[model samples]
Target: MKTLEHIPLNGELPSPKGVALAILELCRKDDATIAEVARIAQTDPALASRLIRQANSAAHGGGRPVASVTEAIMRLGMGTVRNLALGFSLVDQYQNGPCGQFDYQGFWSHSLLMGLAMQKFSNMTGAGASEELFACGLLAQVGRLSLATVYPVEYGRLLDGQDGVARNLVALEQEHLQTDHNELTAALLGEWGIPGALIEPIYHHEEPEHSGFSTGSRPYQLVHLFYLARRVADLGLAGENERNACTAELLLLGGRIGLDAEQLGATVDDLVQQWRTWGELLRVPASALPSFAHMSAAHAMRDEKSDGAAALRVLLVDDDPTTRCMMEGVLSGALGHAVVCANNGREALALAVETQPQIVVTDWMMPGMDGLDLARALRATEWGQTMYLIMLTGHENEDEVSEAFEAGVDDFLVKPVNVRTLRARLRAARHYVQLLEAWERDRAQLKQFAAELAISNRRLAHAAMTDLLTNLPNRRSGMNALAKAWAASSRFEQPLSVMMLDIDHFKRINDSHGHAVGDTVLRDVAQAIQQSARKDDSMCRMGGEEFLVICPNTDLKAAVQAAERLRRMVERLRIQAGETEIQTSVSIGVATREVGMTETDALVNAADRALYRAKQAGRNRSCVVVQGQMRCFP
Candidate 1:
């Protein structure tokens, strides 16, 4: 933060006025107390009433509403009161600034929405004090207002000169004026004694990707929250076309932080309502906007014809082999989705890294990783954060269901896995994925931002369903992989096979070395598995040191050949340890679906039995089970 001494602003920077000025000054003194600040605040009836009313707003008030200035100040905290005064004072004094190109009213409206949005988000995420974040959001972009106030003519000329090429406003500001709004905003916030923690995220909120905060850290969450708040504010002030143009990205921004589409919509609607209430209190203009669902539908409806056209990549997880087969059939055969299956949460997690499924349906209770744990794990990853998750459970406990939702399960399925209910839930999930897919296609055409008039108004290209690709390692997509393979085999009467790979003596390695080295070897081997995998081979972790690779349209010879290649690949990996290179190898078990094989479970069982044979025949070898006969290859 630049000291006020070095900012080099010729005109007066934006500051609190009259009663707000008095409160600010009183609080600046080391000996000053809330009593002194409240006494000054009481002098202005409007300011006092606003403060008292805010103290009693739903966010702050739980008991009897505060009836006095001192009570409100004490309740809202000194820092929050001071910041609110500064924000309200600026709105009062700068309702109409001298900058002709700047929309003074629009700025406040947008800022108010941002304030409301931030407050609502904080409450939802337990990020911070609601009122403090509300005020923080309200004044997050005061630097822009500071610029307009300090260099009215020059800034207006700079704004007008944009001519719609989509140049960055910060760059444009520095080009015309020596300083930009972000710097000025930070300085002003610093001078006003707002904590550096909030100011830092606010400063980088415009392009939070550059903030350099570690992923999942508080600063990272706060910066992204600010960015999302700004997007909500953008949507609030946007024209219909502009709102439609930006909703997809807004959804992505929300999803990046674990908000599924429906939750995001409800939060937006709630914040918009609060924006109206706060707008009235602060005397800033607020306008009615359509609900988030409406805006999303408006944006993607034109591409509706293609919404169900593509086969969605779905990950299905269930501990029961019977249940897994049933759901896989429903998801793949009935719903026309490409499915991947995981028997446990552990395997699902590994596959999630590889396949990048758009949807995940998992059983709540499993041996290793339960559905809720899987949901939380998926939500924690960057790419998995947005993959729609549905929990399949036999329990009807409402508390358990609530726990599941809180754990980040987007939706859930009751026992017996009602196909109709599953379909309905997936329908909503499909809509979200479609909207997400639309965002991916249109992201390049959209402007970097939409806050200013100088932003480009480019025509968005029609939507296309490009495959959802992330850094895949792959998905716990349901047996759709196996089911589809089965469908293909049944359709063409082709061969189908599945291979099981187990890291030989993994527990011994962990026993010999610390778990750190074991972990390193494990990660290296997973990477190797990914590197050696064929595009058509669907691979998933079956359990500790064990993996399942489904080979479709391949005979026993071809499947054995693929397994040999993967075996050699693993054997070649000399994973680097602290002082030594740790060599690891895998034992393979291969099984092919034979004639009259009706249950997909049999293929997996055969592979598992063969895996035991490989281990029993001395580790680091391959064994194949064909019908009732067995063949071993070392």
Candidate 2:
């Protein structure tokens, strides 16, 4: 909400420098292209490398890694590149400012970790651009860095008095520095052309309850996400003794987003590994931390001391006799868990099905079915899906790590593992088991109580059939409607047609603007299609950027005419989102049931194929497949 014009500062604030500044300036032009951003980005080797790395990150880069800066820019988009340049520029300049009390290295480390965490969160929630969210997470605390840089001694003294007490640091900043970090952060983000929607969420993320955002609004979710990212960052950078306290709250936050202990732990562990990689690239110190499961389980252990939590059934699979014996000793002796040992993957699989262990710790590079194969086999079974899996590996490269995890390993340890890290990792496993047990208990109780709630069936059924966002029929509802139309057409010998419509370059709109704007466009387009439909036709939001319109008693020619009219209608839409007005066009594929079509699937499939043709022939028009002939209407 607050911009640079509103915020008052006594000293100069942190800003972009070097090529970052040039890219920022160039991106301000209304006609800026990816080439322009890439050209300027190439002038700075560090920026170029970061761009390439970001473009290829697990969240952003899916198929192939970009080798050129231009491809990287194209993948990340202009908006994301500009924001990243700004954030990275700040990091370069403020790595070690004049502040004495501020942990400059720690600050960057925490910020980088937070950035990675946010990227992972985006992937999980599909909330925003993963790279853009990563940049936001990196600069989420830039205000503190700015304060430390601008008022080194004063800010240093202010931080020095923090005696580990929970207090509103903003109020203290107002008392001492006349401007709090939240206001300055908002102002800086706003000045940098970050959307007001995002700025508001970031500004209120610290106190989201006071944000007054609608319960299910985009801003509400982003603000809470920012908070979760912040907390996870704090936990990563906190001292070993202090991290356990952080895990309890972190778990609660993770639960709100549907992450159970094991899932959350695995997600966090993967992010931390990436944090370490980024730290190396940025030359920031990212400390080695124990697995998230470790800290969570430790806290659970302390809290459940009197609850009589059962010992975990751990199946330790290692080919080495010495290593297996030693691990079994630690599991059964030190950790007080029931341990089972297997000499190889084949033996482990046999033992696993026999014992049905709650946790599986296996080493890679074994005889016959390797650890990965074993994991895949176990996961394929219904029983193994819930089991916690940890793989021990000597290799720690990104490729090897990915391979291990993708093969269904929940977590992994480097060879010749540290006992403490192992203990912590296992604690995470133990916590997951405990959570699962509690969940089963709660589920049973709820099932018993829910047996009498059949009266709500109608309401639940209605919800299941309707699309929540557009109030149009959903994909399933559309299919059912299509089936009925098909049945009537067959019985009455009447024509039935369907059109598959897709919003073209929809991702570009969302990238240039934001999802809030994207949501507006979807709703506007849905209403336009619904209102213009024939009385006998049905419409549905088939999913992102796509819709289906079912036309009963309409012939091929009639369906083509309707598709053209709808295309023109969508082209005329000028959806207003804040100061921006977005106009999008649709590509439609139409199909009419023929005498040879026996099932609705064939008719729908024909329409889908036609839709692909329309997209392939260049969007913003309609295409149809009629009697083995394909035609497009420009």
Candidate 3:
């Protein structure tokens, strides 16, 4: 109910520190280079070794084994390297924290299962990238850790009372902490620079049906994947009864997600195998998981559906015992239906609710409460409205048939019922039932398709606003974010700052070392500048060796100092452009919003002017506009 902002995370939300922090910071830049990431990774031998190992891991087998951090970076890409570093770093940091209520080893073990499940599910469904999914799944429940870290004593009490049956942990958390794990999980992921695409699903994964995400949407599918993964983990870790229930639910959920029983079973097997492998690698305990193929086969034997199916329940009502016995024999033996018999219409009406039959066959002339009266009574209720009704009569009278039709009888059987005709009527009823089921299935598929399409459209739109090279927000996205910040600053009367930066002598580097080397330099420069940025800054690639940083609640002096810091960081970058060691510097211009500044574009233009002054005053310097006057910092 309460927002994550209200919950205090003690400024320590299980984030990757040291080299992992540097790696993540570099990876967030749209123009981050592979060489740059490798360089930073190599700084920490443990992180370097882990990256190489991950690149050569069975899960990422494509080429020859990687022997160096650069090779690993090239093979794994920046995103994968970043996530691995983050995951390994967190494992190193939080192995034994102050959270007494949290099962630290169990947490990692379950997280490993979930992560492996998500990766396998992604590979099978082609839902998203498998590498990122592993991290998403692993950190999906990090909010639980956040709560424990923030409120140890209170959360420990909450965990003590967490029977898992009497009180759901999330509900108990909301009652006491005013926020649940999902909320904190989303917030922490966002803070860690994970994408909104992944964060939103985790946020709503707790109760996805009511999450407002459409049933077939990408986020919706992701939520279901997490849910299925959680269930699979439970099945693996739970006792006999829980495992059986989880297996059934897993199969049903898989079907909804477009996986057949065989595919679903195979996926479960693969997931368990991966879980075992990852458990060993991460040093988490992994128990033997229940085999889906074996469990599913056993369940199939116990709850098999025959050709005629056990779903059909037939009610046979007649005053004559001989007729009732004969009808029951025909329906149960020949039609393969579970038959419930009643002596008269009064008894049939009571049995209808008790047995909830799909078909009802009754004698027209009864001692009390005739077939017509029973049919009318059944039709008046909701459940009986769909039940098929038939009347057995001694003679065929046109007026009687009309009256029976009005009373909701579907067909009439005259005299000694012709077995062939009765079979034909039952086949027709079966066809109708099949059509109803088909309609429902078609409707569900349609909803899923629409949701998928909507999700696809949103992703496409996001791509358009993103820079392909640096993976940072493009100029358009930057402008949009600045506009939003401008509105917020205006409302709250807070200072907003903008810095425009340009890599010095970029054109000369392109001309000297060819465009390919220049491109690498540009990427390295972008990453260096991004790494030096603060948490609240919005960094953007403003076309060709030019970058913009938007800082909210920052003053003129602080903005200048940040710009100067970025210039020095960029100045120190010793990029390897092929065999040549290429050094570069940046000229930065900083501007802050004053009382009269109204438009974001004007603010950006002011920063651009200051940037030009920095360039004019010689490169590798920061210039700030203080009271409409340019002040240069060397």
Task: Specify the highest-TM-score model's number.
Answer: 3
Query: Where in model 1 is the C-alpha error above 4 Å?
Result: 163-167, 305-634
Off by over 4 Å in 2: 164-167, 305-634
Model 2: colliding residue pairs: 293-428, 294-424
lDDT of 3 by residue, 156-256 (tens): 99999888741298889889887778878887787777788988887776677767775467988898887877777777677765566777888888987
lDDT of 1 by residue, 1-634 (tens): 6767887787887888798888788778889898889888988888898888778877753778889999999999888898889888888888998899999999999998998888878877889998999899999989889888989999898888776322377789877787788988899899998999999999889888889775567888999999899889998988886886579898888887689999989988888888888788788999888899999998887545454724578988998999899889988888778999998999999999999999998998898788888999999888987799888888789999999999998887788877788778988998889778778766744553442213212211111111112212232432556778888888998899998889988888889887887777767766776778788877665546777788888999998988888888999989876787888999999999988789788888898889899889987888999876777786
Q: Each candidate's root-mean-square deviation in Å? A: 26.1, 18.5, 15.6
**Ranking of all predicted structures according to TM-score, beginning with the best and ending with the worst:** 3, 2, 1
Worst 10 residues of 1 by lDDT: 459-468
Candidate 1 residue 154 Cα shift, in angstroms, is 0.9
Ranking under lDDT, best-scoring first? 2, 1, 3
The RMSD (Cα, Å) of candidate 1 is: 26.1
| Candidate 1: residue 440 lDDT (0-100) | 78
Give the top-scoring candidate (lDDT). Answer: 2
Q: How many residue pairs clash in each candidate?
A: 17, 2, 4
lDDT of each: 0.83, 0.87, 0.82
